[model samples]
Target: MDVRTLEYFVAAVECGGFTKAAARLHVTQPTLSEAIRRLERECDAPLFHRVGRGVVLSEAGAVLLTYARRVLKDMEDARQSMIALRGFQGGRVTVSAPPALSIEPLARIVGNFRRAYPDVTVVMLPTEDGALAAAAVANAASEVGLTDRPVSADLRAHPIGSNEIVVVLPPGNALSGKGPVSLEQLAGVPFISSAVGTRARNLLDESKERGIALQTAVETPHREAVIPLILEGVGAAFLPWTVSREAESRGAVVLPLLPRVAYDLLIVHRDQPLTAAAEAFVATALGSSPVGGD
Candidate 1:
């Protein structure tokens, strides 16, 4: 019936008598007896057989005793798990992000969170662009998301920082030392472009509407290959400043774009109560310094 009733029944069975169970439970014997009577009435079966100076369990009593112990144990385990989650000692949080954001702020935040809460597991779900990342959070696929912008109205966004878009060129290109390259200069230049729906591709498409065109020498969906392609002089590509810096260290020339194209980085989630692990993750992300070009 109720947890307290089950507890009383179990105590009586374990102590072999209502009198001893009442003593152990710090309850009056009459109170314990009444509780057990109520339980038996609810079940429509006798739980005990009276024997002189002691009691023996009925057939129904044996079945009820087994289940009662399991229920109590399960309740206790649930309580302990909640405590662990609240204390940030255990649990997992899932986060979704595009590749560019994942490289800068998200990667830095995850590293910091893991160091502080080593017991908490962080799961990453990769998406192609800001819209997909926002959709993942809206559909409950992830608890947190990092994106260039939030596309879903149902989600709330936190401004973490911004990443400046930069140009990545092969070593010894003519435009390498020409200060910040303008959109006009890139017209007719061979470029390594990502898929159409990517942030960089979308920006380039918008630029095309304004009469500035970039010729695509190669197009691929895999962003990891963009830097490698640039290294081999396949074509120049656009990348976030943080990623371009890494490419620069590896012999690729990095230059800022004219007019300083930058995208706002956001952390998004549904407007509802979050689990303790997710809350901690959001707090960690908000507290960390902004990464990438200012």
Candidate 2:
């Protein structure tokens, strides 16, 4: 019914109990309980189900939670915008990105943005892949997103740059000194790949569909482990050229793919207006040099 009531409801769900939520909000348990009860009456349904001294979101609660968080985020954005009228002194920009992009452009973009707006806070929300990154922006969980593929129609994509995909091999492998490797040469060679649905994995799947035989020796959810596994001689992998260079310094042999695979780096956001802080962050990203070209 009110911002304070919605905050209390969200806190109760996050803290998992009224007692904890009351403590978090610095309000008495009775007051929090009355606020929740009032909200339930307003909604005409129970929001949470009591179970074993804990709380779980009921069907109505689940639905309300999404809208409640979005409302709270919008309110916070509005407050920050008012603060921004005082010459960009303070605000926050939340970005959702996959691990690979987080390494290059996101890191560089945050550094550049901070040099200009030192008082602004930069929050990084790590998603598994581009789709989730776009989802975060669409749902108001993040102000901006860095993705490697096209997003849905509800968002706008700004082409920031591109990352060249390279092949990584263990130290001293037969292909160590080989020139650019082709898809046919990589066929039958085991690959250390990310889990399916990631852009890199999707490229591999497309290659398979094109009749190129590729073998995945290890498929992992952790992108950080891919390089370590390759260094351990587990298998070769496909990594962004920026990351592959780092792996090369650590003794992994990096080779350019013959056909030169590249993923376009896009900064995505809602089609609607963005807060000043978010706009500045996007501008910084767009101004950065192309990931591999530099």
Candidate 3:
């Protein structure tokens, strides 16, 4: 199969549609469609299933996607290797991280990395799911990932730091005066929670698993809205201690959970070899100094 065809196929999966992929590749829709068709013919199987106005990957397509990404990544790595032999002048490193958990430190790290290596371009992939952080690295879509969740055994992860998860309450709420509130105490109160699949949502699920039937007052995807909603007396919610500290100054009462919970931030990458720029990033993040420091 032609590498170009595989490139088009992967682009379709990432962009979510042929038209979008075509626009992304700066190619005509017909050209993109023809390339995908050729790929399907070579594989002798339909890779995508037409659903509504868009297409979803078929079982065959999903299988092909995994190998396609590896092949593309290998090709890129080979090219970057040659570029590095001459001089490490210009190279790109893509990094992914869970959105809510990594806002502060990752931003600092990226800012520092750019200032230190001005010629090295850093691409930050936007992702909300914490799991995607590690998956991005495994799939070769990104060179490295910053995640708060555990990575699979096939991947290598480095401990960066940890963040405390705390409960936030409104000023007039009964729990406001409490020092450390147990999940049991908040069981009767309506709970504002992060949306499904997010780390905060996982904590809420953990509470339920522990036998606390916390009523869902509101479920939102907006991490920024969590404190504001609590301040408005919408309901209590759990947030990172650093974030909760900011809310505490703004009239929201921050209290530690009965059983303290903290998630470790890890720098994750595939077990396989990484490009030079990726290794540099890993070293910088793992170093004792602040992200981007000498």
Candidate 4:
């Protein structure tokens, strides 16, 4: 049906009934109900069924709602496309990456992009699950994702670089002068591990699966915070070598994990050739700015 009907239908689902939706839409209850009824008639299925005191989506309604969201989004995309063609002052691009990586590089990259384009907008997102690939594939985000893994087989891959996991030792630990500690070496020590749900913990688990037993004494969401405790010699923590590099440069001795565990930082795009903007970003990240000499 019309966009108005879809909008009303979506509102009904959100507001739980025609009356509430009518109030929210600043329309009469009868008008909202008629619109939804028209929509249901056109689709040949009831979109909602009445419960005791509330309304809920029927089986058919539930299925349509999912598609309704996608349709509305595509409408938005169409609008944005038209705006871009008119030489709009700005366009938004969604980018996702882990918190640790975004904190440092995003600012510089965004600044550079703005300086060059002056009109493009960036929506920066920090992902938690460590699966940037899935987010990109779903198109909830842009084709480009910064993560340890490729977004999907259907997407392309480019390495931004790699980071090593280092052991953060507690202050004044007797383990000084010990070169290259293995996961096996720290088997008995009380260690803080990355929290269970994050990508870091998954990496640790996979490492464990590969015969490396991690002795985690604490589990934290921000593993970077574990650095200070290590300097105090409280316990050992593992973090990206880039993280450890900053520490080492500042007098923290970041020993390499034995067997040399390294995580690659990747710039992944949809398996298809990237969009012009997404391609530009990948180039900028790879230190190849458009104007020559990044």
Candidate 5:
């Protein structure tokens, strides 16, 4: 009948029954039961039937469930939108980034964002999946995300930066001294790879596109873990230029990819209108000169 009734009903459905839903919702079973009863009466249809051990959705219930979830989600988003506009100094921001950027570039962005928005809490997550897109689609995270790509059409994606993909070689390897690394150059050498959400995956796909045979000696989700294998000469890898640059400063020679492969960094958000805090966060990421373009 309303947001509360829909929520109570959905929770009851997901938790399998009124008793379980009441426990989860921290409410009395009869209270939740009454709400579902009201919902069914409002629709003038029996939504669920007691089927031995638990409740099963009736045909009408099946249809109502779909609309109920949407209404609940919209209600939640409405509250979130108002919270954003409240302009509270203390708030939360969840960010998802690729592994390498999560360590360096994303860290820097959060650092600066913290100083500017000191009371805001920043949550940074690194993943091999399209976490940014997935989060936005599910409404499970902050509206702003930094990622290599926004693969979901339900989100708006803006290419914000580019990260270098450098060839990492082990010490004493024959090609170590080469100023630049190329796919052809690493042809026979075994490769170390990033597990997912990485330009490495894209690189692997490119190899497939070109019909280039490849071998991966090691694979890791974290670039920090990937680098040590290169140090051990396990095989070479392609990682963010930031990692390569750090290596270069530490006496590890990093060379550009000969054919010029680059990781395009994109900022993504839900396709719908954004919250005020989210808008501010977007403005900050877009306008902040953390990469020293200034």
Candidate 6:
């Protein structure tokens, strides 16, 4: 049977009635009815059972529905594959990243990819944390992602680089004059830190295990707020070197932490095959400079 007739049959079965399906397909009821009639004749059995106002699929129709939907989905997949084979000239790739990461290497890589594939659209999906970013790729909401934390076993992850986590001090603070601040020097100091359960927060927690008890002045979920809080003289905080560099011009002093703590940066995606656009983006990211090193 022709794909159009099969589409009409499936639509009729889904819409529950010929008239409703006709309205949905934007075809006249007679035309839809004729198509289903032809479909039934070709199959040598009735496809639907008539009820008072609607219709239900017959036993034969029930069996055909399964294969019919699969066939249609396969056809669509073939079409997409053809388009992807065209070097993603007019395709779209959805990516997910933490709000903080979307600004840096991720944004730079996305920009570079766009320049190369001007016709392809790159959509950024927002995620709050590394876990959420990994979930987006795992669940197929995003094809690829950048995250600070390790993802589950199902995904492929690559260590792009590491960034030195530094102590951000307010302008003219006593610690600002110190070349490198140590955990012991920071002990009991009022600190502005990331919210609990974050990578940055976990770093602070790990330091506590080494006998550094930081007095948290305020905890914020927004990474953007850390520099501003430090500039306002609220408290000191540990931040990635890339981020702290920007805060330097805003009157914040960035000093390396004494223990030389650093966070590893990663690029993640599902183990499944990537589309052309996703492959290109990942390639660019792999070639880009690592965090703090750039």
Please give each candidate's TM-score.
Answer: 0.70, 0.88, 0.87, 0.68, 0.69, 0.70
Per-residue lDDT for 3 in model 1?
A: 92
TM-score between model 5 and native: 0.69
Which lDDT tens digits does candidate 3 get at residues 1-294?
978999999999988899999999999999999999989999999999988767899999999999999899888887777767778778888889876545656877777777777888888887776688889888888878988788899899998777777888887776666688878888877778897886568888888888888888998888878888988989888777756766789898888877777677788988988887887788878762432110
Model 5: how far residue 204 lies from native, Å: 3.3
Better of 2 and 5 by TM-score: 2
Global local distance difference test of model 5:
0.69
Write one digit per residue (lDDT tens) for candidate 4, span 61-135. 988876676565456556656666676546655677776567445556677777766777777766764475446
Instruction: Sum up the clashes in candidate 3.
Output: 0
Score each candidate by Cα lDDT. Answer: 0.83, 0.88, 0.81, 0.66, 0.69, 0.80
lDDT at 119, model 5: 72
For candidate 6, write residues 1-294 as lDDT tens digits. 988888898898878999999999999999999999999999999999999878999999988886676565445435556788876668777788886678777888888888888987888998887788888777565778988887899899988777677888889887766787778888887888797776568778887887778888998887778888888999988876767777898888778877687677788987866667777778888988776633
Residue 171 C-alpha lDDT in model 4:
48
- Relative to the true structure, candidate 6 reaches a TM of 0.70
Candidate order by decreasing lDDT: 2, 1, 3, 6, 5, 4
Candidate 5 lDDT, tens digit per residue, 1-294?
677788888887787788898999899988988888888888999989997767988999888876776666556557657776676555566677655666556777777777787877776655554454345434543456777654677677776667667776676667666777667766767888786655676786587578666677777766567777777667777766766766555545466778776656667776777655556667667765544111
Query: What are the runs in model 2 whose C-alpha is more than 4 Å off?
Result: 16-20, 51-53, 204-213
Give the Å error, residue 276, model 1: 1.1
Q: Name the runs in model 1 displaced over 4 angstroms.
A: 1-86
* Model 3: CA > 4 A from native: 51-53, 172-178, 208-215, 288-294
Off by over 4 Å in 5: 1-77, 80-87, 131-141, 150-154, 208-214, 219-224, 245-251, 290-294
lDDT of 4 at 273: 44
| Ten-residue stretch with the least lDDT total in model 5 | 132-141
Clashes of 1: 0
Between 4 and 6, whose lDDT is larger?
6
Instruction: Write down the lDDT that model 1 would get.
Output: 0.83
Question: Each model's RMSD to truth, in Å?
Answer: 16.3, 2.4, 3.4, 5.6, 5.4, 9.2
